[model samples]
Target chain A: MLKDGRVFVIPCSGIGKALGTVGRAAMYEVVEKLRPNEATTICLPLLTIGDEAVLKLARNNPCISVDGCPFQCARKNIEASKGKLVASFMVTDVLRENKDLKPKAVTELDPKGLKLASILAEKLATQIDEINNNNR
Target chain B: MAIVKDKVGVVSCSGEDLPEGTISRIATRIVLEKLRPNDTVTICLPLFLAGSEDERAFARVFPTIAIDGCDKRCAEVGTKKYSGKPVATIVVSEIMQKYPYLKAKSRGKLSAKEKELALKVAEEIAAKVDEVLERKKRGDSN
Candidate 1:
């Protein structure tokens, strides 16, 4: 079962960008572990531009956004471009699940965070897989 | 008159308390070690925003290099906001892009090669600092 045929890992590249560290980890989960057919990471610039090529590529497909924090810049960028977002995964939620993971420590990508990201990616991928399968 | 010492500062978004990537930690340490007797070095992390009057302590330094993890530019922008001069900004992605060989197994872990490249970027930053200081001195003499 596939939920959506296309998936986009979009993060805000603003001055407060947190997704690169966290959301990026999640993207790896979806691509490597979950094995999605189409998964691409788009920063603020792409969405901000709303290029015709990008817009057309996404016009027929549903999008799932992964944001690093609550700012929702990823979702906002999509809306600003008149695009629809099927779902969103906020990284803060993942961080909350793992209390042992400290935000203060700027450690390298820890296995715990990776595990958490993969868990979320799994859920998202499963949902997408189901949705796509049902539509067929 | 007291001799004015040139200052070098290392700033990262991952607060001073947290341990960052091997390149960040190791490269920063190397930069500190290379400092001359007349040079001062500051290692700051973004978590210092919670500290009272910490901004004042930061502005006193010069040639600040912000080592941001991603494009969010937290350390780079914060240094500018606090009135601290940012001589250079290094984003980890830019460094990784320079050395495609540093790509991690999965975006979650940095490969050993990536760490080495990070050290190289840090060295470049140090070289930039030296160039900036020398340029400043020349301007001062004019």
Candidate 2:
């Protein structure tokens, strides 16, 4: 179980496309590998379904939503559940910034897709660090 | 029948209201990571419902299994609505009815019985994957 006061990382549960997969991959990289101690994951669907525990967690802590596309499901759901969103990242914006790194597949990421996820993860980790430092 | 070069797609409702949703998610992971690693892929239902052309296109081309948490059948309904009908559908409610002895205890985390039930569902899905792929292979041979 996630403790209180830690930054909640919400990744868009968009498993349908490459961009969504990239967003999920980057989110895991940040929460599990990069800042495991400072941040934890809140399942996005739980927020949508009105899970009180998940909603309470979002309400109490600062959240970072990583959205895969323009629909902004993660961001919208987090806010709808009354959570405080400190920052948000869009995988499309990352692709736009690095035009050459086009993802090859949706289900399984290719080298470029993995690279894109790494780049996004790095950026998200930096934001998490900033939030953690500010709170301290 | 043209041979499909890609693997089957696994779409789970991952619903939050019930432990069944958690089961669907974990069961999907079991199939993707353990049971049929190279033969299956994941399709994100949120993006598909939100109008992703890539997701729709992939679903249209590949065989898919929809693992739904409840009778709401969001994953199954969404897949059928936007793309083609799912090759296989697994509903947790039906699974519970089939095996009344196995009850999921928690929505946040699966208990031992819940994990076992989830694995049972995963094995069922794996078998479905084989069935779909085999049918496609047979079609290609004809």
Candidate 3:
């Protein structure tokens, strides 16, 4: 069974910084666990490549972009695809709020990094619920 | 005066949807941070498409090694379209043939075998970076 509301969670997945992977990990938590049915993810590269199927997903669903850095690639790509953005987040801000937690790896996150992902996921989940409620 | 060495850009596929994508990112990170930190810099694929001039300019002026998770070669394709052609492109799926035992099963968490495979891939990227930089030293066109 699937949930009622729909939103796309797009992570920048930038390999330049550790935060990129953290942001991606957080998005995974949001779509795969927290709001499984309400949110999903698409390949940002595919959308950039002008894939028709992916373009339709962006056109129809509201998007929530999570970026690891100031580049905001996911958010930019979504806008370039003409996708709608309901809300956006920065993993750095999440990290800023949790001064105690520090993420150190870009490839595979450490324990603290994983915890950071969870914290960011929880925040995104709350935003997702509000968007879902508003849409309803 | 200190001699400034040319730097190489490593562009990895965003690979948001696949386990192999996870492997590709890990391998690229190993190369950038551990193996050739001084010689290489990361070029985010999303940044290329999202209109980051600095990344595109770097790829155009310098040699780039595109690492892709699958045959789609998203990183390589994007690099070529936005900037210049990358000097080399490595696809993780092709490398998987050598490590039949490694199963990259999760995006959030990688299996031990997958971690080993990532190391193998990183070694490959590291070697390529060395090769490209050496060529630059030899006055070859990227």
Best by lDDT: 3
Question: Candidate 1 A-chain TM?
Answer: 0.75
What does candidate 3's lDDT look like per residue over B1-142, in tens digits?
2222488888888688788888888898888788998898877888877765766676777688999998988888888888778899999999999888887787767788888999999999999989998998998774
Per-residue lDDT for A109 in model 3? 83
Q: Model 2's lDDT to the true fold? A: 0.78
Alpha-carbon local distance difference test for all models: 0.53, 0.78, 0.85
DockQ of each: 0.05, 0.14, 0.74
Better of 1 and 2 by lDDT: 2
- Which structure among the candidates has the greatest DockQ? 3
Candidate order by decreasing DockQ: 3, 2, 1
For model 2, what is the error of residue A74's alpha carbon versus the real structure, in angstroms, after optimal superposition?
A: 0.7
CA RMSD of all predictions: 8.9, 8.0, 3.0
**For every model in order, what is the number of clashing pairs?**
16, 2, 0
lDDT string, candidate 1, B1-142, tens digits: 2223366566654321112332454455446555332454653332233234644356444556776655656567666665465777877667767777665233345466655665676676677567767766776421
Interface RMSD of 2: 5.5
| Rank by lDDT (best first) | 3, 2, 1
Off by over 4 Å in 3: A1-5, B1-5
Candidate of highest TM-score: 3
